[model samples]
Target: MLLIRNLIYWLLVAIVTPLFFLGLFIGAPLPRRTRHVIGESWARLLTWLLWHVVGLRYRVIGAENIVKEPAIICAKHQSGWETLALQEIFPSQVFVAKKELLWIPFFGWGLALTNPITINRSDRANANRLMLEQGTNRKQHGFWISVFPEGTRTRPGVAGKYKLGAARMAKQLDMPLVPVAHNAGEFWPRNAFLKHPGEITLVIGPAIYPRDDVGPEAMTRQAEAWIEARQREIGGVGPFAHPDERKARTA
Candidate 1:
């Protein structure tokens, strides 16, 4: 049954993608509301196809937190499932994804219509610059931007240190920050297409926006501190930094 579902999932991905792109381009000359409806309609279509065709059930939380205000979302990176799942969380979200994703067969090209912030991961310097510039642009456009701070996934029990990309973007833009942690990797291991059934709980914390008197460094430290503490309180597993160090982080 799982194999059959996977087959249908792949087929749906292949079939609906071109129709999505066609709707995007041909529907562009329509009103802004119409275009937004088209884009959202495509999101819903893909979600429906994936759910009915694939046995994978998707669940999202904290939708109420950022529904009104745009933010920089810092989430734990696990399987590519998070990427697709994020669409269901906020169909209006503009992601900071790897530049290579744009080269992917169908979905990548389809994503280009949404103005996602794609970074060149091969070059650290270039990627950071793009992150900062694009972060501000998307924030100004009233769209939430999600960044997987790990840059890549880790095994279930081996999650690594949190990267500073999402924090840097939040601080630079002086926007509200939201941290979401999930245990998706235990079910969807990296580089493996087989997905096991499990509860992928996405926890969204309070939004953190910098104070007028505080600098980016200070604000980032605070954001990190808050999340690290919450993770431990919730009995988070994997590699975690010292709570004190996170709170006192200046660099």
Candidate 2:
């Protein structure tokens, strides 16, 4: 049953994705924000199809916590589901995605139209510089920046290292950092062909504004603590700890 549903969903996706790509190109001459509207519409459509066709639904907790101003979002990376769903969850936003995504065929071209902060992960210094430079510009243009601090998807019940990039961007820009938590991995596990039918709970933590006295590492720890705690409550398996603490234990 799950396999059949997933097949149907992907078939529909194969039909819809390219059509949206055409829309993206047609809107390419428009302003970045306008192009983002078309892109987000594509994401929203896929999210709707996921619920109706794949039987995987999601509910957002603390929607009120989403701030009015353009802020930085530090979200857990668990599955591709969040990639689509975050477009619906937040306002006009740009993602901090890897530069490799730009090389993909249709999807990459559409993603480029959204004005994401693309970074080459191998060059840490360059990635940070690009993020700060482009992130400031995006925020000034009223686009929230969403960063998956883990850099890539992690399995359900597993905790990935929360990098300081997002926190650093937020601190440098004096913007708010919002941490997000969800159990999307349980239903839509990474690299899994079939998605399980279930309800995914996504929690949006209150905004953590940057302080002159605090550094990115501390802010990153705070975000990680809140996100991981919520993960355990929602459905994640146990023994979550910060990367530093885990290292300290071994040392």
Candidate 3:
């Protein structure tokens, strides 16, 4: 049943994607906000299809933690789920995604229309510079920046090394970082075709302000600590969990 549902959902994605891409050309002559709205509509539609077609639902905790001002979102990257979900959560936002994603066809074109901060991951120095430059510009224009601290998706119960790019941007721009933790990978495994029907919990932790005395490394550590701790509290298995800790948990 789950496999059939997943296939149907993917079929819907294949059918709807090009139609959504047309939004890019249709919205090109309009204002930036208009283009964003068109992009957001596509995201919202996809999210809706995930729930209705795939039977995968989500619940967000601590939504109030989302502040009014633009912020840098430091989130756990587990699967592609959060990418679509975050677009619905934040009003005006841009993701710091890989430049390679822009090469993909209709999807990449749609992403380009949204003006995300794309980086060539092969060049670390250039990528950092571009992140700082473009991230600052996007923030100034009132677009919240969503960055996955791990830089790539991690499997469920696995904790990837958190990078300092988002932290540096937060410190340099004096922006508050909103740490997000979720157990999405448990149901939607990374690059998996089939998704389990379950309620994925997404917890939004309070914004961590970068301290004047603290370096970006310290800030990254602080956010990582909060997110990891919260992930455990929300029943997410951590990669470093003790053998005893894993044994004691209820299934």
lDDT of each: 0.65, 0.88, 0.84
Task: Name the candidate, 1 or 3, with the larger lDDT value.
Answer: 3
Residue 75, candidate 3: Cα error in Å is 0.4
Q: Could you give candidate 3's per-residue lDDT for residues 1-251 as a string of tens digits?
A: 87899999999989887887887878887776778888888788888988998888899999999998899999998888899899998768999989999998877877887889999978987877888889888887889999999989886566799999899999988899999998888777778788777778899989988888999999899999999887776654433233443555644
Residue-level lDDT for 159 in candidate 1 = 45
Best by lDDT: 2
Candidate 3, superposed: residue stretches over 4 Å from native? 236-247
lDDT of 2 by residue, 136-213 (tens): 899889999999999899976688998999999999888999999998887887787788788888999999999989
Q: Residue 99 lDDT in model 1?
A: 86
Per-residue lDDT value at 78 in model 1? 67
Residue range 1-251, candidate 1, lDDT tens digits: 76777767767767776787788778666654455556666667755655666545555556666546777887777676666666667636777878888898756766666767898868987887887888777777677888776677755434466677777777678767787766566456678655554345566767777566866566556655665554443323212333433344433
lDDT, residue 90, model 2? 94
Q: Which sections of candidate 1 miss by over 4 Å?
A: 27-40, 58-64, 122-129, 212-251
The total number of steric clashes, by the backbone 3 Å criterion, in model 2 comes to 0
Put the candidates in lDDT order, highest first. 2, 3, 1
The better candidate by lDDT, 1 or 2, is: 2
Worst-scoring 10-residue span by lDDT in model 1: 233-242
Worst 10 residues of 3 by lDDT: 236-245
